[model samples]
Target chain A: MMRNLFERTGEKTLGFLQRLGRASIFLFHVLKGFPIVLTRPKLLLDSLYSVGVLSLLIIVFSALFVGMVISLLGYVTLVDFGAEQSLGVLVALSILRELAPVLTALLYSGRAGSALTAEIGLMKATEQLASIEMMAIDPIRRVITPRFVAGIIAVPLLTLMFMVVGIYSGYLIGHGWLGVDEGSFWAQMQSKVQWNYDILNGLLKGFIFGIAVNWIALFEGYDAVPTSEGVARATTRSVVYSALIVLALDFILTSIMFVEV
Target chain B: MTQAYIEIKDLTFARGQRQIFDGINLEIPQGAITAVMGPSGCGKTTLLRHIGGQLQADSGSVSVAGVQMNGLSRSELFALRKQMGMLFQSGALLTDLNVFENVAFPVREHYQFDESMVRDIVLMKLEIVGLRGAAQLMPSELSGGMARRVALARAIVLDPALMMYDEPFTGLDPITLGNIVTLIRSLSKSLGITSILVSHDINESLSIADYLCVLAEGKVVAQGPVEVVKATASPWLKQFLTGSTEGPVDFHYPATSRANDFHLEAKS
Candidate 1:
């Protein structure tokens, strides 16, 4: 019984390590071949149009609601302290420093990341990738690299858009509706939210989240067993794994970027 | 004997606990049509994959032309693959691309040719398969035979020296099956390409094949010229060729007796 337990544990550990090694190699290939995308701008643009442009509705709607919720939450708390005037700083900092990057990444992982995994997984299952290899074209350079570059570009840009729409919507709800002073709201936000400290760090988070999400996506797809069930499982795994890793890394990056600031 | 165009020596392969190929050896003659025919579960498709370098043997040397498949680097293997073409059972055309682009895929990716050159070559190849009119059609729109023909067109568009077809006649109607068999034989003659076909369509295969190989239970049971195979008297080979399940091939599944397993009284 003890020996069997040891064997099972060892097998599980070996499997996990093998997966990690394969994922690392896949990530290295994506980074190494990333420059190839410059010659193939159309692929990246198409992906951006898919991953970024198509997610616009959800991002805008979510940002608006999230911004209003933050305003409401901040307003309730500030009423206790008699500092409702600080709602501008509260909403601005929350959106720029945290919500924009993290929430945008979560949405992108659910939407674009899942689709990328499914598409590539299906291609692998169908032997289209193998056919590409047989034709002397590198599937990594031809397929995944463009998509990876696009994800990196699109995610950050989408975060910026999210931040913009979100902060303004917060302005409407906090000041336009709740009767926080319009002057004090603008004044407090400008005074408190430093560009380098909040905005740049948030964009950086967006960029890193983009890379992590796509890396997980492409890895899951490439590593998926060539079957319908395998592809389906990998698609779900990509979303779940990408979301968890993005959130986890957001904490680490937030500590490194913001804790110091 | 002259060196074969493709050779496999001491090839052994297994999937999990199931042995697919056991120290198998094969030599495909140059510029000939060779058909590998066997019972349904025999490793015919697996053999083609080993030759294609899609699967590696547990212990063997698979040489294509002069290149040893396992010894080749990733890039080298791909370079070797460029000299070969494979038609899968389902056609395996990229669903995203239309039929013309599917045929044009290999040529366009490999060479820096202009669109016109691609169009001409693609049209010419499609014309051979009688699918030129179906160029703009999606793979989803293609009939099974049409899809296979389009795949054949894609396989040949690069004009590779070797072509592998997996069950080209398995699900085809009689007319389409006849058409595909004729196409394979005619194309082999015209292109002078060595062809390895995996199928169980005995009449069709034997009709077109210069050489025939039969695999059973992870080993080559018989292989020779079509006339020699036709003359052979092995019971295993005869039962297979004659499609008689009552012979060596057990009609009963391998299992404990039904009475013992189900705890039932035996029928008188």
Candidate 2:
């Protein structure tokens, strides 16, 4: 049993290593396919529609709810310290530097990342990628790079949208409903939220999260074992892995961006 | 004998634990439709992929147009692939693209063809496959036969010197099968495209293939002109040709007797 256990563990480790190698190669090809991304405007536009435009409604709603909840909670917490007027400061700092980027990515992973995996995984299973290869067109350039570029551009824009909706919803709750002073809310937000340090870092986190999410998604899809079951599992893995990586990366980025240096 | 366009020498391949091809050697003549026939999982599709450079053979060589396939660079392999085209068993059309764009894909990707030129060329290829009327249809909307025809149109649109069809006639109605066979024959002849067809459908292959190679147990057990392969009395050939279940190709799985499998106590 010990021997069998070792053998199984070894096999899984080797499989993981091999997949890591393939994923690296796939990523390199995608990066190398930058030329194609620039040259093929139609591909990028089409992917933008699918990845960004299609995902608009969900991003909007999730942002609004998250905004409302944060403000309501902030109001409750601040009231105890006689700091309810500081609700705007608290909400802006949390949403701009942390919640907005991370949550938008998590949602995008569920929405666009899984869709990417399913679409490309099905294409792999049906040999559409191979068909493109047999046509002498690089599938990296022809299929993947545009989607990668679109995702990179889309997620950050979506995050910006999320932040806007979240802030407004916070206003509706904190100022309109909770009877917090509207002047104090906007004033604290404007004064406390540093544009360069806070907002820029948030957008930067969104950018990085975009890369990490789509990278995992596209890799899983392209490396899907080319079966129906394999594609389905890959789609599931794409969401799971992208979410995990985005959250982990968000923590790392938060540390770096918020550091004194 | 015609000159060989594709030459495989002492090729060997394996799928994980099981060896699929062992020292298989065959030559396909230029401009002739060569059919590789065997039962399912006999490396027919694998052989096509090997020639297409999608899979690397473990040993020996696969050369098309005198280009060694083993160590070619990515761009070189793609250059080699540009001279060849393959029709997969499932048609493998891009689901997102309609028939016209599917046919136009290769031309659009490889060349700077203008919209008018792209449209004209795509329409012509579709017309050749009798799918011009289906240009607006997506792959999902196409019937199996129509999808295959569209795939064929796509494969030939680039005018590759070599055309490979992997089971082009599987799961088709007889009329559709006949149409495919006629199309394969007529297309190969008119376009001077060397063709390799991997299939189990004996009637369709025999009716269309110019040369024949029959594989069994991971090797080419019989190969010659169609007439010669027909006359050859090799047991493997006979088993394959006659579709017999219980000859050299065993009907039973390689397992113990039913009594032993069931753990019978005694045979009273």
Candidate 3:
């Protein structure tokens, strides 16, 4: 029993290391193809149009609702302690710290990440990647690079939009409907919030989340077994795993950022 | 004897626990058509993939056009693949790209040719496949034979030294099959390229194959010139060539007892 346990543990460790190695190689390819992405404006524009502009409404709506709910929750709890005026501060902090980046990433993963994996997976299944390779073209440079660069460029921009819209929606709900004074709401937010730390940390989280989403999508697509069912499975796996990782990384970054302060 | 352009030495491949090809040895001579014919599930497509460098062998060597394929890097193998052409069973054209773009794909991706040069090459290849007027058509718009021809044009666009056709005549009417076979023969000869054809259309393939190989149970049961393969006494080869229902191939079906059970159940 002990021998079997040891063998299983060793196998698990080896598998983990192998996955890590593959991820590093994928990252290396993505980095190497960055220049090609810059040179190809059409590809970049297309990806931006797909990943950013098409995804704007969903991200904005989700963020607004999320912000309103968080503000309501903070207002109810603070009212119990006679601190209802702090709702603006609470909403601003939550939007910047947690809700905005995570919610936007989840929405983006569903729309952009699933599409990326499916498109690439289908290309692979049809041997289009083989054709590309046969033509001495680097698929990473031609196909993967544009998607990765687009994700990196798109996610941060989307997250910023999410934060702005979310915070405004929260303010509208709290001050306009909830009867909080407009003058005090802005005062409370400006006094209580640290812009540098909150904005920088959120942007950092967005960047990492973008990388994680694209990495998972590209890896799943690249390793996609060639079949109709296999491509479907890859698309689902990419979205699920990327969303999970985005949430996990958000928690880690949030704890690290606030714990020191 | 024609010089062996693509050589396989003790090639073997296994998928997980199942051995697909075991110690398979074959040579495709230069400037001639070599047809690999086998029953379904006999690893014919796998052999074509091996030659195209899509699948690697487990324990032996495969060399094409003086390049050792076993130890080459992925990029090196890709470079070698550029010198060869392949016609997939399903045509495998990119559905999103139109016919012109599909034919021009390899050229545009590989070479930095101007638009005029790319257009000229694409039109020329399409013309060779008798698809000059259908350059703007989508794959969905084309028939099976037209798609196959488009695939053929894409395959030969770079003027590859070797061409591998995987089931070129599959799922086609007799007329289309005949035309494709004729095109295969005339194009390979005129282009002076060695071709390896994997097909189940035995009679048609035999009409075109200068050299023929018969695979059964992961091994070469018979191989030689087309006339010699036809004269072989191997019962399996005879059954395959003659399309016999009662022969070595009957073993592929379920046991007689199970077949009898089905009949009895139908009667009851």
Quick one: best lDDT, which candidate? 2
The sequence of per-residue lDDT tens digits that candidate 3 reaches over residues B88-189 is 888888887899999999897778999999999999999988899999999999999999999999999988989989999989988888889989999888
Each candidate's interface RMSD, rounded to one decimal? Answer: 1.6, 0.5, 2.1
C-alpha local distance difference test of each model: 0.89, 0.92, 0.87
Model 2 stretches astray by more than 4 angstroms:
A1-7, A259-261, B258-268
**TM-score of chain A in every predicted structure:** 0.96, 0.96, 0.93
Superposed by TM-score, candidate 2 places the C-alpha of residue A55 at a distance from the truth, in angstroms, of 1.3
Q: For residues A1-261, write the lDDT of model 2, one tens digit per residue.
A: 999999999999999999989999999999999987677798899999999999999999998999999999999999999999889988888898998899999999999999999999989999999999999999988899999999999999999998899999998999999999999999988989899999889999999999999999999999998998999899999999988899899879888889766
DockQ of each: 0.61, 0.91, 0.47
User: Any idea how many clashes model 1 has?
Assistant: 0
Q: List RMSD in Å for every model shown.
A: 2.1, 1.7, 3.4
Name the top DockQ candidate: 2
What's model 1's TM-score?
Answer: 0.95
lDDT of 2 by residue, B42-80 (tens): 899999999999999899999999999999999999999
* lDDT score of residue B41 within candidate 1: 83
**Residue A125's lDDT in candidate 3:** 93
The reply for model 1, stretches above 4 Å from the true place, is: A1-6, B1-3, B262-268
